[model samples]
Target: MAVHSNKTATLIVMLGALLLSSGCGNLAGHKNVDRGLSYIESHEYEEAAACFDAAEAAGENQRILYRAKGILDKNLGQYDSAVENFLKSLAATSGIPGDMDFDTNYYLADVYIKQEKYDEAVEVYDAILALRKRDKDAYYMRGMARLYSGDHDGATIDFNKAIALAGRNYDLRIMIYKALSSNGYEDEGKAILESCLNNTDPNMTNYEKGQISYYLGNNADAQSYLELARNERDMDKAPVVLLLGQTGEKQGDFNYAISVYKTFLAEDPDHPDIYNQLGLCQTNVGDYEGAVNSFEAGLALGNNEYSKALLMNEITAYEYAGNFAQAKTLMEKYRKAYPDDKDAEREEIFLSSR
Candidate 1:
């Protein structure tokens, strides 16, 4: 199995911003902080970091500065650096409200989880819960950490607490179900999903139901709901298109996946992820040349940080076409590019023997 990359939690960043807004900082510092937030919204993480630096240099609120720095570092996959900054933010006396300590601790815990330091994550979450006994997100995240650490029974207890606290929160319930199913509690997870499906609320969108069903492994229901949602007026087509391609791929309909990805590319030519999906579908259909082209185009989009899986997929396509020479070359390049990656090291060994 491919090692899935970690994602930064946007909830932590948003909460940090709310905490920052409670600041009594100088005008210039606040202005720079606002600029940093705008840069973050535009995905210019480096620029946001620079803005945070400037705000700090201008004697801004250290709490916001450290929190923003932590957020940017997390997005950049600098987990250790993010943890350092988040700790600093939490330690700062001013700017951050007392209640925001939970969020800052949550951010630190999440960073630890991304780093696969599950013990540290559990510790931080434990501390968060000790401070605020009713923090549902902390309980859920702690459960996730426990699950990752192979403490299924402990995870179940935390999940139960989360469910009890969540009450009628449909989204949170679905998230919990997904977490459970993904971590090997499929029966319990499916039961929750079935209950949700039977008690469908009129306020829920087909897209939401589709995502829920997809996570529940109900492919036919997922496809039906997603297709219905796609046809609705004023709908956002991007995610719908991607999920449709995924559903096709999951159902082993490579041709349908290829078609959907092609349609998506026409609408979003620069999208890096769809290209990887398109390449996978092409490779599955014995279209090695097309797969190579798609992977190349995706690499050309300059998303190196998120392109590890794309690179691996491309190399696999080469191998499937009996092009061991090219696969070996790509594997060597991958090993060089991500020297610390265990998977890349294993791939190098495997390709060398091939």
Candidate 2:
């Protein structure tokens, strides 16, 4: 299923400012546009706003300028400001009957998504459908809006419509894969994700491509993509690496799994998830002593409910591995902390019997 409303999202990367020519040179602040963009790139949102404000003040009044401002405000996490600019862009255009309207709606939906205002986003997407019922992006985005807003049935219908229209867009297809995963259709989702790597375009980052492969149980291919897409700031690499470790463990490659997890964890210390993962890895490798210590280290910095489970895990590993003294010590504290857990009562029984 896909979003069957909101006919906006990038139809093509190049059409970011569709139906608008760069020839409108004299209407407003034409000069500072690049400067505004530069400020945005540097993460200096206030400065970026100044540049856009100056252009708007100078009477640029062009939809293109508004689009630029939208991008700037989006980067600043000012969802309200971003939506205002995107709306201006849509309003300024005489009439975007098809793809152009799609682009605006897509960006607008994205802004609403960032704000977690999915109901409003769904309404905006509905408007897009009013213009072009068969628009693929609209259908896809509406599905997402509905999904986030707790309208599972509405979301599914939109997704199905999007798939019916054109399920080939890898970016669009990823939505289907994600929905399947969220709904716990893991095997079906994995198959869908694997099929996505068949086509290649230079613009598609390898890191993103790797994620699809890893999700499909293609560890080698995922690694190949990760190595090729190596960048220090890449948000995907660490997660992919972690996934690789998990894959290795699933395949009984303990040494390699541990190595991968440790290396990834080194770079992401204080990552509670990674710490928890590393502790699990250590336990599997028969390093129960190390497992206890690792979980202890994670517990110091990890203030999540998962930490309690991990502590209990460490206690069980200690008990199973015949570290009776240590198990007794942890069992006492665990019982005190999780008084209602039947498992804690059972652990006390086991300790008493021992």
Q: lDDT for each of the candidates?
A: 0.77, 0.69
Span of ten consecutive residues with least summed lDDT in model 2:
5-14
TM-score, structure 2 vs. true: 0.49
**Candidate 2 deviant stretches above 4 angstroms:** 1-29, 97-101, 131-134, 167-174, 183-246, 249-354
- What clash count goes with each model? 0, 21
Once fitted onto the true fold, the runs of candidate 1 whose alpha carbons sit more than 4 angstroms away are: 1-107, 110-119, 129-136, 160-175, 303-305, 332-340
TM-score each candidate.
0.67, 0.49
Mind giving the per-residue lDDT tens digits that candidate 2 earns over 1-354?
232223333222223334443455334555666688776654455687788778866767466677788887675566677787776666556434445556766788788887888886887777767667788878888887887788877877887788778844665667677776787655655665665565555666676686677667677877677667645464556565666666677677877877876786677666655566777888887888877777887777746556677778788778768988888888877765554366688778988788
Report the CA-based lDDT of candidate 2 relative to the real structure. 0.69
The candidate that achieves the highest TM-score relative to the unseen native structure: 1
